[model samples]
Target: LIRGGRVELGDARDLPFTIKRSWARERLTPDVHPGGFVLGCNMTMHRDVAARIGYFDERFGAGGPLRSAEDTDYLVRAMLLGIAVEYVPDMTIFHHHGRRDRKAIEKLHRDYSLGNGGLCLKHVRH
Candidate 1:
């Protein structure tokens, strides 16, 4: 179990943003199981579990068209394999790459959608 957020590098004015605050709060008081989603930047897994799951998928991550959902795929596989996933609110990491502008945020959302669709096709197709 782990949690994390983005922090502006060397920017005193950049406080913890709304999304990060929401993530922290959600981690502290999860109304549902934390396995609903996996935050890749803030995730931790046991070595045994990682080995069993064979780690993250190589197709989905940053610097690719998929752009995300590798963490989602890993967590889904872990759950299917009967691994218990927990969220530790205290475990946090600062992500140096923060999207500050509207254009970047839009692109992120777009990429996330694409990655999510890809995940669905990979796991849910029958």
Candidate 2:
């Protein structure tokens, strides 16, 4: 797996959006360090790898009840199966959906938290 960049629509000074953008860029860029996990928006894999991994978990992501963490789940599984995941800084993508409001951002965080917990329970239990 290879991850890429995510540039937001607004100026860099835009509060939480700026912070989020910076965090993502720092993680995904090679200049800093290879990302700890793959983001769904910028993930890439060869057909063989995809076939071996069996693709993303349908139980997570936007339309699902969990609302996120599918990418993390997939990355975790791939790593467990001994796959190499890489972060590629040059492959950039622009993200326009930067939530400016506090409520929206909070909700996003909450959903991700819940999804992460669900992923852990589903995959980490003995």
Candidate 3:
């Protein structure tokens, strides 16, 4: 992790800031929707769902102006559109963000905030 601890995407029980105690540690069921907190690195969807939702907004992700929240925005769109989402806790993978230096770490946080703000604006305007 950038700040020194493990970035446990599976179970965020150790994290104090999350509203849900278990975070991504949910049983595989349609009843459990990940909402906008879904991580892009660990998600799968059917092609039809992709077709229905189009693609992640280019203006909100890593290569775009916002530099984050593309996954969040995509899932937000899915949820808003009434798409059926299921969280599969059994399927997992490691995410190596590679932000080692202090500058990179700070930039990550900055970009995250900026992206989040932009996402909020976009949704609020709609």
Candidate 4:
């Protein structure tokens, strides 16, 4: 899955930072080679990766700090399963990060609290 708010579509030469283009511009270069080039782009992620590693844990809401790590945890699980995450430098989109409104935040807090409790119960039972 694409991470973070900023995204663009192009090769590394067109990047705002110093980057090398020829090195695996449309693939996961860092996983393949330490010195290989990298690209930052918005991707419509293929479903094959999730077909094995499972989907995001919707239990955590955005407001809770620990909730933020849920995505990281999912990505880590994906990497453990030997899924190759490719960074397509030629296609990108800038995401707009949105915060919840006050009411939304309050509702999220309640949901998050219940979700964490459920998680604890599951672990305890397991």
lDDT of 1 by residue, 49-87 (tens): 678888578788786568877777776676667676655
TM-score of each: 0.72, 0.74, 0.69, 0.41
Query: Which RMSD does model 3 reach against the true structure?
Result: 7.7
Residues 59-110, candidate 4: write the lDDT tens digits.
5335444343344344445555665555554443543323325665565456
Off by over 4 Å in 2: 6-36
Q: Which of the numbered candidates is closest to the native, going by highest lDDT?
A: 2
Candidate 4 clash pair list: 42-92
* Worst-scoring 10-residue span by lDDT in model 2: 27-36
Against the reference, the lDDT scores of all candidates come to 0.59, 0.63, 0.58, 0.42
Rank order by lDDT, top first? 2, 1, 3, 4
Top-scoring candidate (TM-score): 2
- Error in Å for residue 37 of model 2: 3.1
Clashing pairs counted in every model: 0, 0, 0, 1
Model 3 bad stretches (over 4 Å): 1-24, 27-36
Show model 1 residue runs off by greater than 4 Å: 1-19, 22-36
Off by over 4 Å in 4: 1-43, 59-65, 98-126
1 or 4: which has the higher lDDT? 1
